[model samples]
Each structure stands twice: as structure tokens, then as C-alpha cells.
Target: MTRLRTLLVLLVLWCGVAASALAGPIYRVTVDTAALAGQGGYLDFLFLGLQDAAPATATLSNFTGALEGGGVTAGDASGSGAGRVILGNGSGWNEFAQHVGFGGLFGFDVTFEVGGAAGDSGTNLTLALLDDAFQYVGAAGDIVTFALLPGQADGVTTDGNFATVQAVPEPGSVALLALGLLGMAVLRRRSR
Candidate 1:
């Protein structure tokens, strides 16, 4: 019985250590008009670091506008095979304008749009965070840095880039794990 108790206690300690080890790092980023903007649209990009060697997937939400209010949805650009302007990047800085909102515990939302003469054409660009292996990790509040590329209707201009960071718990639930280890340690000491 005593040997069994000791083994259980050791097992508990190992689990606790493993849980702590799995607590992945948190990264975040945000962009505002100050970074990049134009007469009718803007562009923002975020970059995040990967915690492990495992591959990560990145997801993007709608973009919110700051001034002339309008929500930018994912849509293909003129003659471009790209999926959507708001979500993916291709050529020029794409217009992004909308109120940023956190979708839920796992994701958030941004706004984007385009404005200029009917025939006027330009591009907005934003980069997604890539891991060492060049894999994309979904953009969350925990972003490391971001960039804002201005639209080029006829010229380029420097604008504001507003961003924010939020904390997110590691993927796995490891709370209360310490308490379990403590109980096991006490049991082992008592047995000794």
C-alpha cells in the first residue's frame, strides 16, 4: 500500500510539471489609422510568434472602419483570383475600416473597405504571422506586432496604426493541477 501511494504521488508531480511545460506563450498586435490610411480606405497587418514546432492555422474576421463607418467583408477584387480583399492579401494596400470586436474566446473581428473615384484603383496589404516553418498561426489578441500599408490611389501617405494586446490562457486546462500535486507531496512525506 505504501509503495502504491508513493508511485501515485510521483505520477501527480510529473503531471503538474508537464502541464506547466505546455503553457504556450501569448502574442498580440493591433493597427489603427495612424499607421496607414488613405482618402477612402486603410490596411493593417499582424504578426505573431509560434510557441512550438507544431503547425498552426490563422483565421481572419471582418474589418471595422474608424471614420466613414462601414464594415468590410471578404470579397474578391476586380479580375483578381484572390478569395477576398478583407481577409487575404495580394497587391496594393486594401482598405480596412470597422470597429474591432472579439468574436469569442478564440477569435476577434476587424473592418475593411475601399473608397476613391469609381475608376480609381489601388491595393491594401496585410501580412499574417508565420511560424519558423512558414506556417500561419491564427491571428488572436496575443499578436506580437502589426503593420499598416496605405492605399495608393495616386500617392502614398503615413497614417496612424492603432493596435492592442489581450491575454489568453494556454490551450489546455491546467489549473487546480497544482493543488493535486501538493496533495500528493503531502501524502508521500507523511508516508516517509
Candidate 2:
């Protein structure tokens, strides 16, 4: 091949490498039930406004909680393609439900990778909690809502409030994965 053509191909391949290197950080958000146990309220419904986040990119299904009750249902609302905004809004929210309330003792972790940095504030994760149909919880007798704000949902220490656990991929691991893919590509080409 001509030198110019080879250089162009190398440039294109380098671009792909850079793009693949820019993998987003994975996070696991748990709707903690430590404090909610025996609170006469069931955290059955969990919703998220992923406006700036990326839910569709999630490869794994929602993590089922260890609760004995109604059951669990999880899916990516962004797939509905109802509108431009995937984040929870008037368009809709990526909603997951345990059907049976955790009753404050059982909690599930939903791991996801944001399109932004591993822990960027721009990837704010707002959360909402709902009870069984028509069931009133708390003194307000209204649906309960909680955001995984800083210090609000610290899964590390379990503050008894909603907690978020960020699962950032190890750099060495990601590099290994990228290298594996590259090697596979080279092998396929050589065989051809």
C-alpha cells in the first residue's frame, strides 16, 4: 500500500483506540432499606431521571433485591424511544420496581455507567421511591422521593439512607480488555 494510505489507516485505527479508551465509569446505586425497615412503608417502585446519564448503555439487568413479597421488574425506559430526553421527565423515567416493598431490610444494587466521568456531578442521579398502590407512607401520606445526593446515599458505610456505590473499572483491567480486542482483530486479519 502507498505510504499515505498506510498513514491514513493508522490514523483511523488510533482514533478508534482513543475512543475505546474513553470508557465511562460504572456505578451501583442501592435503595437502602436499613432505616426504612418496619417503617410501615414499602419501597416498591424506583424511578430515575437519567437526563444527563446513560441507562441504555447498561449491559446487565437490574439487580434483584432479597425480599419476599410481590416480586421485581426491571427494564430500560430509554428503549421506549418515546422522546429525545431519556432522563426522567414529562417524557418518562427509567423505572424499576421490586413489586413488593423492601420493607427497609432488603436492598438491591443497580449498577450503571454514566456517559460522563466516573463521578461527575453532571451525571446527577436523582431517585424516587413509591409504595404499593394507594398505600400511604410517612406522615405526609404522599409518595416518598429521595435523591442519591452526596452524603445522602453512601453505600460504603451504609448511613441508612439511600446509598450509591460507584464501581469504576480498574485502569489495568480496561487496558487488558482493549488489548484483547485489538489482538483478536489482528488475528482475524492475519488469518484472512
TM-score for each of the candidates: 0.32, 0.41
Superposition error at 136 for model 1 (Å): 22
lDDT digits (tens) for residues 1-192 of candidate 1: 979986886786677668765443333324332322222322324221222211221233432333223334333222111222223333223323222222211123323233333433333234333232334333322232322222322121222223444444444344546567678788788789
Q: What lDDT does each candidate get? A: 0.35, 0.42
Which portions of model 1 miss their true places by more than 4 Å? 27-161, 166-177, 184-192
Q: Each prediction's Cα RMSD?
A: 15.5, 9.2
Q: Report the Cα lDDT for candidate 2.
A: 0.42
Model 2 bad stretches (over 4 Å): 1-22, 38-62, 67-94, 103-125, 133-160, 170-192
Which lDDT value does model 2 have at 66? 51
lDDT by residue for model 2 over 28-67, one digit each (tens)?
4455555455543344333454454332222223344554
Compared with the true structure, model 2 gives a TM-score of: 0.41
